[model samples]
Target: MFRFLVGRLLILIPTFIGVSLLAFFPIRLLAGDPVALLSGERVMSPERHAEISHQLGLDRPYIVQYLDYLWKILHGDFGVSISQKQPVLDQFFQLFPATLELSLCAIIFAIIIGIPAGILAAVKRGSFLDQLVMGTALIGFSMPIFWWGLLLIILFSGILQWTPVSGRISLMYFFPSVTGLMLVDSLLSGEPGAFKSAVSHLILPTIVLGTIPLAIIARQTRSAMLEVLSEDYVRTARAKGLSTFRVVGVHALRNALIPVVTTIGLQVGVMLAGAILTESIFSWPGVGKWMVDSVSRRDYPVIQGGLLIIAGLVMVVNLIVDLLYGLINPRIRH
Candidate 1:
């Protein structure tokens, strides 16, 4: 296991380097100049442009700039955000917990709702319940998150007024951001109604963000369970007079989970990508919204740095998922 972990860590070195290269080059190729965008409405004079360029090392050759960026990254300097006027890493860390909280909640929601739905669908294959579960999963999978989020806002927030439209919490709450996670921070602050406010604000966006993953996980689980249920071991368990629950829950589901877990692991990337749309729609203060803003302003450091950091995070999640395989099924550790 140690050797396996070491090997995976070693693989990430080149993977991260490749990600850095991809993040760095593409942003520079974009048409808008970050310095010019930084000037806003004012026309940037040549001197002003040169001054900003020099300050940002944009005056340097592409190769030199790329090398310098990499060197700084190696030294733990993500460079300053031209727009925010803060360290890129600092801004990222500040926003990351919000994204983490949302993604974690979204995944948890998916797992709790999806897995059981899947198990039921598998147990009653070809029945109305199976069709209903599969049909809902299909529709959820097909729905666009942005559009769904808008519809939700229109119905729940606009018409019914059941949830807050956007933001992490109601403006009425003044919770200090201890962990940068609104839910946790609100509870810690002991601010009256803050936790409830946070949860209410979270519900719409969480549902929007989690929908696709829930669909995917449910389908994956159902498929895996169905395949596992047909195996000889499952039949043996049944023939041995094991309770239906024991046969399916202990034996079938456990074996089915290996592939289902892999599917869930792969969905981490999908979740992050989906968060970009969900966060933007919900105005959630997260790395996704930050990246979108950076793109508009052509904030090169933030864009490149954010992409690299997010990509690295995805890779880390995938590695952790791979490690989890050993825990779920010990044969993989060999």
Candidate 2:
């Protein structure tokens, strides 16, 4: 297990380098030059352009600039965002936690809703309940997140007035800002009102972000369960007079979870990507929205940092899922 982890960690270096190279040159390929973009109208003067280029090290050869960027990355420096004028890494740390929280909540929502629905659908097979579950999953899979978010906002927030429309908390709450995550900070500050509002804010976005993954997981779980249900072990359990629930739950579902686990891991990354749209709709101030704004302004550092962070997260999740297979089914570990 240690060997596998070390191997996976080592692979990140080259993978990150490749991603950075792709991110770096694309900015250069854009319609305008970085120096001009930085200096704005002032760069219209040739002398000013030269000064701006010198300040930003654009005067260096392309290879030199690339090497310098890589060197800084090795030293844990992601450079500053040209637009925000703040350290890119600093911005990433500040915003990534919110995105992480949103992704986690969505995945948790997916698994809690999806796995049971899948199990029930598989167990009931051709029953009306099975059809109902499958129909719900279909609708979830077909709907785009932004549209769903809007519909949810209209129905839940606009019409019923059950939930707040935007922001992480109600303006009235005075919670401590420890981690910038309202739930955590609210609990730390002993502010129940803030906690409630935070949870309320999370629900709509989480549901919208979770819907597609839940549908996928449900389908995968149903298929996997069905396959396992017919296996000899399941039949043996039934022949041994094991309760139907035990035979299905202990024998079939456990074995079926291997693929479900993989899907759940992959879904974490998907949820993060989907949060871009969801966050924009709800004004959630997470890494996703930050990435979108950076892209619009051509803030290369933020864009590159955000992409690298997300890609790194996905890779880590995949590796963890691979290791989980070994633990869950010991045969795979060897």
Candidate 3:
């Protein structure tokens, strides 16, 4: 177990470095000159541009700038947001709960719906039910988040008027941000309908954010279940006259979870990436939308820092998943 954890931790170093390289150099290069992007509509004087560039150390060689950025990262200094003029970490922490809230809700939503659907489909393999599950999974997997969100908004928000079109909650509610999660904070406020309001606003975003992961989990779980159902242990359990639930859910599903867990783990990263679009579409005040806003404003420090922080989060989740995987199926530890 120790060895497994150590191995996973060791992998994070190079993975994080890769994330840094991808997050830094490519974005800085392909996004055009930061100074120019920051200028927006009005053309700025060349002198002002050079001054801003020098102030931002854009005047230095690209390698030097990158190394300096890495040095700052090592020192736990992600730098201040040029647009917000606040420390990146400060803003990150303040805003992270929103993203965290969205991500958690999305993943939970996925797991709750996905696992059951997968199990059902697997139990009825090669039937119409299985075909339906797989077909729906394919459609869910293929649907673009932004388009899906808009479609939901049109149907639910615009046409039906069932859910809010945008924002984390209604403007009427005000509560102390005890946990930064709207649901908790709203309950803490003891205000009427606050919790319900929070849940309502969360519904659309969660569905939109979770759709792909749900699809992936469903497919992965079904595949894993099918494989495990044919295993010797499962067959023996069935032969022993164990109940259908015990044979399938206990013997088969338990073993099948290894791959499903891996799929869920990988989905965490995808969830975060999807949150970027989901938040934008919903105008949720989370890190994803913040990152998008930062991009428009050309806040390079925020962009780089946010990317690193998000990458680090994904790494942490993956590590936890690896550890869980090892515990559940010890064969992997070897």
Comparing 1 and 2 on TM-score, the stronger one? 1
lDDT values, one for every candidate = 0.92, 0.85, 0.91
lDDT of 1 by residue, 1-334 (tens): 8987888899999999999999999888889888888878999899989998998889989999999999999998999999889999989998999999999999999999999999999999999999999999999999999899999999999999999999999887774678888888999999889899999999999999999999999999999999999999899999999999999999999889899889889888988899999999999999999999999999888998898888988998999999998777778878
Q: Pick the candidate with the highest lDDT.
A: 1
Question: Please, what is the TM-score per model?
Answer: 0.95, 0.90, 0.95
List clash counts for every candidate, in order: 0, 0, 0
Every model's Cα RMSD, please? 1.6, 2.4, 1.6
Model 2: residues with Cα > 4 Å off, grouped in runs: 1-14, 31-44, 59-64, 330-334
After best superposition, candidate 3 residue 107: deviation in angstroms?
0.8
Worst 10 residues of 3 by lDDT: 25-34
Candidate 3 segments whose C-alpha is farther than 4 A from its true place:
31-33, 36-43
lDDT head-to-head 1 vs 3, winner: 1
TM-score of 3: 0.95
Model 2 agreement with the true structure over 149-199: per-residue lDDT tens digits: 999999999999999898888888885578877678877888657788889
